[model samples]
Target: MSSSELVRVGIQIICEHLIEVLKEELKRSRKNYREDVDVGGLDPLEDPESYRNHLRMSENQFEELYEKVKSKIEKQNTIMREALPSRLKLQITLRYLATGDTYGTLEALYRVPRCSIGRFVPEVCKAIWEVLEEYIKVSRTNLLNNIYLVHSLT
Candidate 1:
């Protein structure tokens, strides 16, 4: 074969290997999302009230927060490939906050890898904070005035 043809063949082989690796990764992610015992066993949709114990949010509150933060937390499938569902992302974050659990513990509960859990927790938290910023942020005037008063007293 010509040198150029050999190079093409080499590229093709590399592409095939990458494709196989991506396919396997996708399969494992899909399995983790679908068949994870904790994900299935928790069944937040089936018993949202019971889920409250774990997430510290009632069904209505969870839905409200989910809707508010959905745009921020939602991931495009093309880039994220096996993106966690918005609901699942919120659940995992809330569970972490409620329980003060490590990512390792969350990995066992949510079946997402600890590395992914680490990323998702922060992403979801930032999204939630953004969604609630209007309600959560203190008035700068009030905050500054209080600080000034405290400093003056000191």
Candidate 2:
């Protein structure tokens, strides 16, 4: 495949992997919230030790987390459409690929399937890099003024 196409596929693989990690992270965070936040029962001050709360959120914190998650997700979607971009999935995927996050740990940040990530990343890598080589090599050598570099060196 062409380098750009390959790169796009590669990018997609990374994005897919990142999506998987994100999905997992999101799931894990929900679980933590379920366990720790303890929606509606008794205050910790009131009851120190039982399976106390059942509510997923307190009115305030719930509102806050909800907004943050919603905002982040929306931002991600918005970034996808933009021409100049953050490359959201790639960033997160890089984090995982670079950081070696456990699936469970990754589950907290991304609500994605690890299997899907594992399965497709190779394809994405292949697609993107192959195309990428051509894309990068197909350079337009328009000579810009070298005065900026010349001055800086002097």
TM-score of each: 0.61, 0.25
Tens-digit lDDT track for model 2 on 1-154? 9999999999999999999999998767755553442111233355433212222334454334334333223223231232111222333333344455654454455544456344333333333334345544432232112322322332
Against the unseen true structure, what C-alpha lDDT does each candidate score?
0.73, 0.41
Which regions in candidate 2 have their CA more than 4 angstroms from the true location?
Answer: 38-154
Q: Give the CA lDDT, 0 to 100, for residue 3 in model 1.
A: 100
Residues 1-154 of candidate 1: C-alpha lDDT, one tens digit per residue: 9999999999999999999999999877866654443442257778777888888878788889989999998886643255678888888878876777777777777777777666666677667766777886776467547534532332
Model 1, global lDDT? 0.73
Q: CA lDDT of 76 in candidate 2? A: 30
Clashing pairs in 1: none
Error (Å) of candidate 2 at residue 23 is 0.6
Model 1 misplaced regions, further than 4 Å: 1-41, 137-154
